[model samples]
Target: MRQTKIVVTSVEDDNFCKCRFCDKKIAEIKNDIMVPSAEECYKNGNVPVPNFGWFCSQACAVNYETKFDINFAKTKEGKIDYYL
Candidate 1:
């Protein structure tokens, strides 16, 4: 009989020291929340995980969601299109 050894891999840390949304300094790791950039939020059309509070912390994300149409448009051929 042969015995095999297994290795464990660790997840990469973002090390977010500040809250991207509120621009608040994170005193602790638990309190830290980092959001994506304005372009990312706009491209995704939604907020990503770890992004607490508002969207990308930029006015652009807010404007995109607020002023733009959030409705999903579909063509007669069954093609779907999302606008924001």
Candidate 2:
């Protein structure tokens, strides 16, 4: 039999940090929340994970992505449209 190695993380989300996806307060990682993976995010219209704190929930991430995409649109003539 062989031995296996395990890794542990000390990283903790800032209490004051807000979810980039929803502006909701980020709960402590000690609470054992599930942060969505980048690949998983793409399925919901390419949501972006923050460089720091994560989203409050997966739904918020999806909503955030779609809202961002709504800012732009394609014209009938294949032109890029930007909206405020």
Candidate 3:
């Protein structure tokens, strides 16, 4: 009989607690309110861009920027174009 090794994967229950890959503390909340993930609060570049926060890092930021900005710009100009 041949014995096979089984690999077990562990997933942390707290998504907002820290980075699963990096194990970095995302945020510190004193109140009872829930804290947002680092990817949600900071851009992939680690910059805090409110209303559009995302995972901040070289790869993540570039991916998000190209996906959202470039794709949106490809669309026809809308009525609000003059304001922009």
How many clashes does the backbone of model 2 have? 0
Better of 1 and 2 by lDDT: 2
All candidates in order of TM-score, best leading: 2, 3, 1
Q: Output the lDDT of residue 10, model 1.
A: 20
lDDT of 3 by residue, 1-84 (tens): 443222212333553433323345554433432255333334223333223322333344445556667321221532111111
lDDT, model 1: 0.33
Report the lDDT of model 2 for residue 8: 18
Q: What lDDT does each candidate get?
A: 0.33, 0.40, 0.34
TM-score of each: 0.17, 0.35, 0.30
**lDDT-best of 2 and 3:** 2
Point to the candidate with the largest lDDT.
Answer: 2
Q: Write the per-residue lDDT of candidate 2 for residues 1-84, one digit (tens) a residue.
A: 343221213244453334666566443333443333333323333322333334445565546558877422335753322110
Which candidate has the highest TM-score of all? 2
How far out, in Å, is residue 62 in model 1? 9.7
**Which residue pairs does candidate 3 place in steric collision?**
43-55, 43-56, 44-55, 44-56, 44-57, 45-56, 45-57
Deviating ranges (above 4 Å) for candidate 2: 1-15, 27-53, 70-84
